[model samples]
Target chain A: MPTIFVYVDQFKGAALSASWETMGAAKKLAGEMGANVTALVFGHNVEGIAKESFAYGADSATLCDDPTLADFRAQPYAALLAKVCADGKPDVVLGPNTTRGRDLFGMAAALLGASAVADGIGLALKDGAVHVTRPAYAGKLLSTVVAKSRRPQMITLRPRAFPKPEAGAGASGSVTKVEPAMKEDDIATKVTGYSVEEGRVNLADARIIVSGGRGVGGPDGFAPVRELAATLGGAVGASRAAVDAGWIPYANQVGQTGRTVSPDLYVACGISGAIQHQAGMRTSKLIVAINKDAEAPIFKLARYGIVGDLFKILPALSAEFKKRLGK
Target chain B: MHVVACIKQTPDTAAKVEVKDGHVTWGDAALVVNPWDEYAVEEALRLKEKHEGKATAICMGPESAKEALKTCLAMGCDEAILISDPALKGSDSTATATVLAAAIRKMGDVDIAVFGKQAIDGDTGFTAVAVAATLGWNALTFLSKIESLDPAGKTIVVERSLEEGKQLCSSKLPAAISVVKDINEPRYPSFMGIRKAAKANVPVWSAADIGVEASQVGAAGSAVTWPEIYPLPAREGSVEILEGSPEEIAAKLADGLIAEKVI
Candidate 1:
């Protein structure tokens, strides 16, 4: 039977949620190929993550536990994972498409000489080949890549692309520690400090996003958009017009070159929608536009439009929302 | 302080490209040095200008990437070395990194390696770290500004950008750093710089010259495959479109939101 290796990362004993998403992908492939899915736990001291990996549909987890592996460095991690892959002979390997995953995937692929498809949004099995779909051209287009390679096909699945499996009832798996080929100098990069960005929930993962544009006038004009987002427990986003205006931070910008989001609700306030901006948020489930110019291009795609200044509309909506919420 | 900036002639950042038969054909699309790599080159020049060192631009791409190479030269790189091979078509990030590491090794005396955080196309943010891993160098990513470098002390200080704000870190020499867009405003090529870049000799390296087997340089060596390309999913912005007075539109939008349970 074939084997699949799913990498589930843990920081301070808690596994990243996206790694469970990878396990879901691995599980489906395991069903089709009759392969047993295994998770690899690195840098975790306790058995908490290993047992949870089994609960998430992994058959077994091979733990590479060494205090030296405590810090996350690509070199030692890659060398260690390569040793595991060589010994395990996984027919397929899955990882979350993230910063850490990107580094680990590249190093592992180079060392294992395996084909790696990255940031894939979905997977399709066709004619005995796994076809993975991913965004390119900065989310302007999607590319479906196939790995016509041998054993240990590697893929980094995109966030929120698939459903994470529900925890099984009383799930458990075997655990073993595999020795790795890591030298002391291999872990050269030091984690001097870490500063996690705390703000609006990651806009990429938010289901509701309220975005402003240059028409909002300037950075000072974004307070209403921020307020509206807060009212709905949503994230705040901005158009390229706003980002380039230096009105809002570039990280909040929604455009082809920026982060792509598929929120359930996308509200565009005081903005003329450009093609690039549309490309990023086009897949948003619902689009509401509030532009003073009735002829604005954004109105064309907006399901609902209010031809007025965002300053007027956002406050009205916020007040109305509060009223409805009995505030 | 010797500085080596690894650059690539990525498709113009603004160019929209498509994959056809496993090749990126930016037909009608302008080609330029990657936006981030240009920053990498400019940052290199800035460090050299301040610290009194030499910054050589090393590019790994096809011969045609000479345009990018020339631009790098015009931007004031001391030298240009091209790592191009026929077998390197469709090289994934890993293969690309491997080839780059070998090419840099061949081009010795490299204490520091700088790269654009990522090429715009793949946005994998992997190649710089991968090369660092293979070359046994420390990796720093998303750098906003290099505060200072003291080769004598073998240490460097820089602000590394995170999603919220930038963190300041000082790493040892011989490390790999990927700079972001805001690192420094990349200088426009002056006429004199353009002339110098145009007249500069860019030595091209084959796979053998770089000491990497041809099979291990391109698509053949890549483990991740680019097998499919497709148009993105179409979103039907509600056919339940509302055309009405401002009051009515707001009312309908509100009702629509309520109907959709979004409120």
Candidate 2:
């Protein structure tokens, strides 16, 4: 029987929500392959996360605790993960297809000489080997790939691609402590510090997103966009044009060249839907576009479209949502 | 100092994509350098200019990919190399990275390697880190700013853009770094440079030429197999356009969304 190890990623001492989603994918694939699932958590003094992994259907958990592992330095993390994979000799490894996952898993795959499939949206088993379906050409095409290499097929599941398994109360599992094989000189990268921008919700984690585009006019134009987002208890986003025009920061840009967002609801204001932008938000559950041009491309992809001046529409919508939601 | 920047030829960002015969076909779409890699090329040129080094453009693809290398050359890359092999069809990220790493080794004396955050086609963003690992070099990604570099000390510092914020990181020399668009604005290919690149003979290498085993490259070496190729799912239902005064339309849209419990 094959054993699967899923990395439980943490940010700022908290478990990334995508980690559970990855567990959901691993559990499904494990069932298909008749495999066992083990969760791997790494950090400084993160024993609690190892226990929490059990609630998400992990049969076992491993924790690697060290002061050097405190921050997410890529070299040390990759070295430590390579050591764990070498020691565990698992048949498969799963991780969330995020920034850190992309960096860590690639190095891990190279070290283990395993097959790597990053940004996997679909997983299945065929003839005792795993097959992954991932997007290519900027989500214009889906490519199903089967790794024909040795054991320990490593893959990173796209964020929110799989349903996050509900945590079970009092779920039981075993925990193991693994000694890392990292030398002090092996770490070539050091994270000196981090500074999180204040007063902004993460676009990836937001349930609703209100986005602006070039039509937002200027820096001050984001006021209404923010107001609508606030009224909806959501986050704010910007099109690459607005970002490039210096109207907003790149952190809020959503598109092929920017961040990919799959919010429950996406409200596009003054944005003409370019294929580049659509690639990022096409997976959203609902799309609403408000553009001045009646024939803008955004209407084709929007479930609800309103053609008008966004300056007049956005504020009104914000007010209406506030009155209707009574919040 | 010597740096290598890897580039890929991809369908333009706005091009319409289609799949035929279980394969992706570009269909008259202009082939251009991958948009993300533009930053990598830009950063490479800037670094070479600052450090008085040479930047070579390396790529693995069909012969047509030479067009992308030409663009890199036109953008001030000192030299261009293309890794092309008949046996290299359908190579995955691992195989491609393996080829790049081997090519870099053959070139020798590479102090730094650069790439974009992700290719616009695969959007995998795996090659840079994988290549770094394969070369036994450090990897840094999403770099927004290159603060300082002490080539003599073999140390470099940069700010990496994360979801939450920017992180200050330092890495050793002989590092592979992927740049975000904010790192630099890519310059357009000059007419003279384009003329030179068009006439420049980019050296092409096969699997054997790079000293890589055939089985370790192309489809045979790739772990992932693309069994099927298909278009994305179509959006369901029809769009409903609400028209009225801004206030009235807003009110109706809110009520409708509320009634559907989608807000």
Candidate 3:
């Protein structure tokens, strides 16, 4: 039977929740194709992650534990992954739609001479091929695609697209150790160091995001937006216009050119809701827009909208939220 | 040092994208250099200026894409090339990277290559890495700053902007980098630069010029095939504009959000 391999992505020795989600997806695909599901865990110490993968429904877990594999530097990592995938000759390979996955998967695909699909939301087996559905044109369109003639078809599943699988009744899967085919000398690039942004919630992981746009007016205008976010214990985001205008940093920008976020609740204050901006937050579970112009395009996607001056609405909302939350 | 910056012409962000009869139409939208690529061009020009080297703008698209290359020239690119062929349309990121890598190889002396983090269209953000893979070079993506460069040593250090923080990375020369907006400020075209760009002749190359097979250049070479595409359904509800004073509206909205437990 063909095998399906799930790349277990981790950061700082902690496995990402999306890894389990990918394993869950691979289980379904395995059921449909009668294939065995294997989780490939690589890091400095990934034995625990391998065990966890078994509970998440993998038939086997392959571990490539090495200090050199801790931080993801594409070349050596892709080389090792490509080598493992080649040896296993899996029919399908799955990874998370994340920074590491996006950076590594294509190189692996090229190395294996396989088809690579990005940002896949839906997957299925059809006529001996894995078909995928992905958003195109900035989420304004959905395209169903198939890697018709490729083996070890590669796909990066969007985070949260698949639900996590229930843990198995027992830790029942086998663990195998795979030696990396790459050596230190083969790495052309090195990560010298990292500087973490202290005291801020990552927008991608934030359950609620309070984002602003040109409607925030100027750099100082962000104070009120930050205030509301603080009151609600949510992250602060901005539109490209706001970032470009120097009102906020590009790190906070939420749009097609910026980060793609799918928060449980997204509140937009003063954003006009251009297609570029909408594309980033369209998948949010709930959307609310506050704009002075009732006819603003953002209102079209908003579950709730307040058509009034943001200068008045924002302060009032901040006061109300603070009072209600008692924070 | 020779630098090559890859650029693409995309519909303006304001355009409403529509699909009709399997073709994408963006009504009345002018094709311009991708907004993000402006930073790439700006960074390339900066590097060229600092090193006293030549920077060339390269693109793969229809004849109209030359306009985008001209804009690059106007922004101070020393020369430009347009890789155009009928067989090259609808190319996926991998195929696009293949053609671009071939073109860069044909250039023969590109010490560094620059690209935007991602184009507004397609938005795959993988071409730089794919190109680097094709060339067996390092790809330093999401770079926020070009911290240092050693031309003689053929090494460059860059600061990469990640979701949580910044990472300092170093790579050898002959590296492909995809830069973010924080790298530099893009300058507007000057009158002299505009005149020079307008009068300059841009050389156009076909698939054969790059030594790529027809089947490996366009849709035929793509790994993924789009079987169906349509606009996302419009949100079904009308905007229920709160009709009250600011305090009343705020109270009502807060109550509603709290009731829904989405606050």
Off by over 4 Å in 3: A165-172, A309-327, B243-251, B258-263
After the best TM-score superposition of candidate 1, give how far the Cα of residue B67 lies from its true spot, in angstroms.
Answer: 1.4
Report the Cα lDDT for candidate 3: 0.87
Superposition-based RMSD of candidate 1 using all C-alpha atoms, in angstroms = 3.2
lDDT of 3 by residue, B144-211 (tens): 99998988899999999876688898889889999987888899999999999999999999999999
TM-scores for all predictions: 0.89, 0.97, 0.94
Chain B, candidate 1: TM-score: 0.91
Candidate 2 lDDT over residue span A213-264, tens digit each: 9888999999999999999999999998999999998889899998888887
Per residue, candidate 1 scores C-alpha lDDT tens digits across A1-327 of: 888899886555678777898999889888888889999898848467888998899999998877767756667788888889988888788988765677687777767777677787787777766788887766767887787765577788876677778988799889997865776665545555656566637675677999998888988999999998988889999887788777877678777645667787999998788766876787676788888888888876777767776787788788767666666
Clashing pairs in 2: A91-A152, A137-B121, A145-B225, A146-B225, A147-B223
Candidate 2 versus the native: TM-score? Answer: 0.97
Model 2 spans > 4 angstroms off: none
What lDDT does the true structure give each of the candidates? 0.77, 0.89, 0.87
User: What's the TM-score, to 2 decimals, of chain B in model 3?
Assistant: 0.96
lDDT of 3 by residue, A39-135 (tens): 9998887799899888998899889998778788888778888899889999999998877888888777876667888888889789988889888
Q: Which window of ten consecutive residues has the lowest lDDT sum in model 3 chain A?
A: A180-189
